[model samples]
Target: MNRIDGGFGWVIVCSAFMTLMLVDGVLFTLGILYIEFLDEFKEGKGKTAWITSLIPGTMLTVGLGFGGIFLSTLVCVGHHFEKRRSFAMGISLSGSGVGIFVFAPVVRILIEEYGWRGTLLIEAGFILNIIVCGAFFRPMQKQSGRTTEKSETKEEAIDLLRCDDNLIYIKENCIPSDKNCTIEENASQDDDVHASKQEIITQTKSTKNTTLSFFSRHFDFGLLTNPIFTIFVVSNCCTCLGFNAPYVYLPDRAEEKGMNKLDSAFLLSVIGISNTFGRILFGWIADRKGVNRLLLYGTSLVICGTVNVMNPLNDSKIYLMIYASVYGMFIGVFVSLNAVILVDLLGLERLNKALGLLMMFQGIATFIGPPLCGKSYVYNLY
Candidate 1:
């Protein structure tokens, strides 16, 4: 940690942010292309739906698994500094929201002027931003502090001098008040020795209970053992189950109500605009007004939005627009609440592991949510 406070870390952050934004933008906008391919390829029912659905499957399932396994290592980067941790996380987190802000209009305009194929090409370019971002993501280089041979020798002498008076005693035996203490003194007097013994015992027990692999810590089921943690996980899973479907299907719904394709595309941009506002305003309210209560209010808004969406007031364009705007606000709240709620539940120390696992499970929902909802819509229509 002492060796890493320098220029290269920030460079890595910027590069990683750019690349992640591109990949994430592609994932978010896949829904828009689902309908396009459905029409263009003349696919029927479930087959046509796979285009958008398939993409996120790779992201959610594969990406999440890898993230969970490596999260312990990945989260270590933030441990070196106290002040920069939140700022670093917030900076990274804000990328997805920023991606939404940047790409929403671009998608709208491209789909408006050219078509879906053009939009995919544009999304591909956005994905390439990963490369740009990756360039800056260099591993932290060790910056050793300056030390001459004389200073090194002096430090060693000082350490020896400090140790001379700090004699350690066993339960029944007295040790010398100098560096000449024996293994018997270590066994009796040293807390570090006791700690090491305990650690060895723990590893032995763990090995007895589980298989013997070098990377024996292959999984962490300790997270799911907590009841409150389990409940939040389930709630988030259900939330994702219904949440993304509406956004993905909204354009189609608008068009079904006799809106033009261009207008339908524009509606998504409007939602993004409203979502940006929703995160900022509601995030502030959550902090000031109580995060839990504010979250309940947001969840209530989601329920209301869902019910509003089910309305047959399709002919009333103003009512439809109003619903869309409100839905955007509700979803924005939902998205922001995701991390905040996890932090509230788990606290900062375990947040990365909790989030990694939470999102891995949520990824299952993300992968399955839209398609299941889409399929249900078809089945209900029949």
Candidate 2:
């Protein structure tokens, strides 16, 4: 019931790991699938991009927003952690790296065996497991204000049916669990809660409130007023803008240079594997005293971006593999530190909404980054 940094917290970590593995694994490997689409459709880079429907932007969006599972899965694991949180988060966030490691080659095989369409179908079915992961995300009984907590709590209620799950104790009132669902019962059981025109208006307002809450809860615009967080968000946007481009371009870039298709695809797996180790290694180091998470995050991104800049320098397959290895390792830090840095920047209380906003911005950049990189190829700009 309580977070002792173990027990169910590890359960949460495992759930987060698997959920993210599905989320990022499938999404990151869109590059392999994109190659299939290019050969199948033979469309321009920019236009074919919308084809991410991971043809470029579409699959990434699907991974990030599909059923709106991305942000919640990310935040829930952190909520269950504290003392060894950096390490726990490292272990959990490494799931993405693991996903990337596993999915790239696996997806390539699926494409070769089944074709892109069948592969996409199989991948969709794979992503459906994210829902199963959500059910395991039992809410923590931490203290917080009712109104402020309602945003995330209600979101979880609607998605997971927490009250009916019987895993949680309902102490007072509805806690946004089943307010309108229980309205009729309330009226029948108590005359003071009579069913009247007021109830109708109340129900209508509640419906409107639900819509507004969903919007505000996920994208709290007020966060921009925090100059520090705003800067962080802006910096994140810029970093992510190019972060995914390598994954999308690597396969095609390799094939263009006459690398074998399987080897080309394996480059992503190299990144994934290195990333897995990097996350655990960096996380372990970050959790130790005297290491600055922000500085660590910046250093990781710097090395990652530097690696990206240097990737194009060598077209040799071995060189590319080396590039993938180094690039993947540092990006692992970026992914693992994402949640931890948010806590350092905004504290735990603001973590949920802050993550939502930050993820949304990252999503926008992600949606545009790869396709633009592809377009550059078309225009001889790269």
Candidate 3:
């Protein structure tokens, strides 16, 4: 079959980019959703909060960890064109950046105009776009060069084998014909060689298949059996555990501290803005300074940010803003670093599975972290 360059390939790339952008934009819009959810569902806070929480919590819990399945699928889907793979991924990732830029202002406007209920519907509409774009994602197919060559060679050999009667000797060498050869006799001999080559190829492939396949194989208890991997998994989970709580609670906390609505909203924006910068900065750092150092630095920052929660000087608005900024910076850096560090330790081949496993743990944290923190703050308020 002829290769399809002009048909589905470009469409698939466009779809992947839009899908990621839409998915991530909704993910980032969680802060807006959480506020609306809290006010709307104050009587059933715990249960309803889960509705707002499920996506990121699932995404972080499932998306980050198991998200490699999609990542690998993307690689396999786009693998045929060597030149386009990086371009495709770059385009896809750019969705997050674009989503953030678009979502910030759009969300601000929607909240101003329609309030939370309308904002929720708009965000839902954005996420639904992923489904529309995803429909266009068909895998690229390359022409089967090996199968074509093998078929042609087999046909030529068969034709030559049938060229003579004393063909046994001729089949052994596949010499076209001699005076001593007959077509029928030589044909059987040629079959033996053809079968032998096919058998060798099959045997080689079977032997090589002994190694584990797919990213998930690494998670098959070997890493779990190791003390170090277990420690890393647990520590990373703890780090992620308390990580997003502050972001969810920052606006509410600002209001509690006697900051006006505009300032509280600005505080939320500061976190979002800082978070975008943190992801970029730490992504670069993780690639260069080693993921381990970035992890340590990021975790320490989270600890510091958490400690700032009990700041004795809660009366200082300027100080509080700085603290929130630093906290956002640290958490954002840590979140990005978590992926790189896990991938680095696990190595690229096994990274996705390992992260998927890690996210299962983080998902639990996502479910528990915010409410627990929020309730505690509420208790103190009373």
lDDT of 3: 0.57
User: Where does model 1 exceed 4 Å of error?
Assistant: 1-24, 64-98, 108-118, 134-219, 289-312
Candidate 3 regions off by >4 Å?
Answer: 1-22, 44-48, 60-105, 129-147, 150-219, 258-262, 289-312, 315-317
Give the local distance difference test score of model 1.
0.57
lDDT of 2 at 280: 86
The residue-by-residue lDDT of candidate 1 on 206-264, one tens digit each, is 87776644223543458899998898788778776766665577667777888877666
Predicted candidate 3, C-alpha RMSD: 9.3
**What lDDT would each prediction earn against the true structure?**
0.57, 0.78, 0.57
Worst 10 residues of 2 by lDDT: 53-62
* TM-score for all models, in order of appearance: 0.66, 0.80, 0.63
Which has the higher TM-score value, candidate number 1 or candidate number 3?
Answer: 1
Q: Output the TM-score of candidate 2.
A: 0.80
Global lDDT of model 2? 0.78
- Model 1 has a clash total of 4
Off by over 4 Å in 2: 53-67, 142-214
Cα deviation at 192, candidate 3, in Å, is 12
Candidate closest to the true structure, highest lDDT = 2
